[model samples]
Target chain A: MLDAFLGWTGVVFVFIGVFFLFLGALGILRLPDLLNRLQAGTKSTTLGVVATSIGVGLIVRGWILFAAALAVFLLMTNPISSHAIARASYRAGVKLYPGTHPDKCEERKWKLPEDGEEK
Target chain B: MRNDTPILVKKITALSLITILMVGFFWAFTEMPKGSSVNVNNRVSRLYILKNVKAATKSLNSGNFFAKGMKPLRSDVPYSPITFGKSANLEDGAANVVTSIVVDYRGFDTLGEVTVLFLAATGVAMLFFGKRKKNIIKAQASLIMSVGTRIAYAVILLFGIYIFVHGHLTPGGGFPGGAVIASGVLGLFLGNDHYESNHLGLKLFESLSGMAFVIIGLTGLFSVNSFLANFLPTGVIGDLYSAGFIALIYIAIGMKVGAELSAVVDSMIVDTEEEWS
Candidate 1:
């Protein structure tokens, strides 16, 4: 009974992993801007990796579990790297949607105080 | 235009071919898992230590005086002191023993790590500082979002402090806590447009903490044979006041990392502003 339960949990984890992997690929293809695409790709892929690692960990216990934990830790770091890349792309003159307004970077010079009063 | 189209097509094809080749090579190499025999030496030693430690601890709790006096043999290569009746919990001064070891006993490695951090900060600052370009996207946060975010920011700031303070007793230490503190500043960056960090204070903290670390190392040079030796009295073991040089090193690391990371984040955010102007 315990073995069956473990097998079912493993299958569920694998399914979730596959779902996240598909979602990440779809997001990469579908997202409009570079930043949005990067976010989608990193987040979904990280989740996918974590789920897959957990499934693998459950199937092969002991030392393999350490590998799974390491994978999850690596997954957590993926977003930070992706964010850096997206920021770099933005700084390198990548364009975004036409409707976006009042760029924070542009308004830094003429920024008004929080209370709508001049500093 | 026609020539350019063909060139682009050829480039794309070549890129894809290379990518496929690389992927195939990696896959093929990964498939051959040359399994090595498990070296049970460390595991066996660890198990033996754990068993004995557990029994000793149990006996101590149960008022068995003989078992309580038994001391575990310290590893000789590492040269950890074998002080009897003192549970020299090296990791108690910092959550990560490895980090404590690297930064405290091996202060030289920490010097390199800090230097790398400093270089990374300077590099990012130089790259982004004082450049002006247009950013089209605008942050349109609602009033509720703005207020709630500020509250959350305060909570996270406090949490970061907690992590830094109890770093000796917890899973988190200076680096992680410092990063968390940096993220809190990021929250400000997200919420406000013209949020500039106090550059002078950050620089002062960075320089001072770094100097203190060096001074501590030099003290060890004068007092002991090894660099970053525990020159101070090793107080009552297992107490917070214990671990002579360990606590001092942790404090120095905490200050340095916190300041450095804050400066880095500040620079990254400020550089974006310069690009816009």
Candidate 2:
């Protein structure tokens, strides 16, 4: 009974993972800006990876350790990668969307007149 | 003859070339036999699994083929293919056949591959080597990015070490693990201004590892009367210390690869990490 329940849960989790991945792929295709695409890609992919790995672990024998490790790595690295991409875009002077409000990082650049001044 | 060929002739030549390439690619893809389709039952892997660990048997291809060729190959293999992935666990006492094969069976090939990689790294470093200009200021990454990159770098380094350490028992091995380590250091070089690769540390790590690999091979030659023979004791299979020289060789490879890759990266980023004056 427990095995069946776990199997069913895995199936459901896999479906959910597929859904999130599909959404993320769509967002990547449709998103206007680089930041928007990265945001869509990272967040959804992280969650999708977690769900998919868990699903696979439940379905397969002796895969829990690998799944857990992969989840931990994805969780740790995804946001960090997104942050790096954002930083790269900003450094490259990529303009924000026209309709977007005032940017805080841009504002902070004006606030700090000299280098090594900001905490 | 005119300086230029006719447009019609040019088009025909291009078309013929494209058609030939496409046909060649398709023929190669379709006609070639897949490795997976081959009967594993006929392979030495089947026999390797059934028997207990022993000294390397002289194969028909290697030597003494005429006498040994008389006996029929074993058919009563106890375990199926599913249960036994590779005979490395039973015969060689190494869990990972990929490592065993790469570092043991085809070691000389791997040594040549390593040499090629080293030469490439050296050539790249030499090509990029020069005195630094004082005026070229590098822009620092954002605080959040810097912190995140540092954390990621640490995680990646740990993961690489783990990969190479468990190479004999796991899916990953020295080459991939070393690449992982290099990428992590590359992240540091990109994010941090003061992230200079220590020449002494890198050089010592690389050279010592290379020397250690050679020494082990030489010791095997002396001990077993063969190059890179299983000289060290093969402990019980599936343990960290089980694979003996395989693990040690992988560790050495990992260090050498990581150091060499770091040297390559350091060469690319001249201003940040310069060679000694």
**Tens-digit lDDT track of model 2 for A1-119:** 98889888988888888889988999999988888888889899889889999898887748988998888888877887788778768777797777667788776664322344333
Count clashes in each candidate, considering only residues at least 3 apart in sequence or on different chains: 4, 0
**DockQ list for all candidates:** 0.06, 0.30
Which candidate should be chosen as best, given DockQ against the real structure? 2
* lDDT, model 1: 0.64
For each model, chain A TM-score? 0.76, 0.87
lDDT by candidate, in order shown: 0.64, 0.76
Q: Where does model 2 exceed 4 Å of error?
A: A104-119, B1-37, B41-91, B128-136, B272-277
The number of the candidate with the highest lDDT is 2
iRMS values for every prediction = 10.9, 4.8
Q: List the residue pairs that clash in candidate 2.
A: none
What value does the interface RMSD of model 1 take? 10.9
TM for every model, in the order presented, reads 0.48, 0.78
Model 1 TM-score (2 dp): 0.48
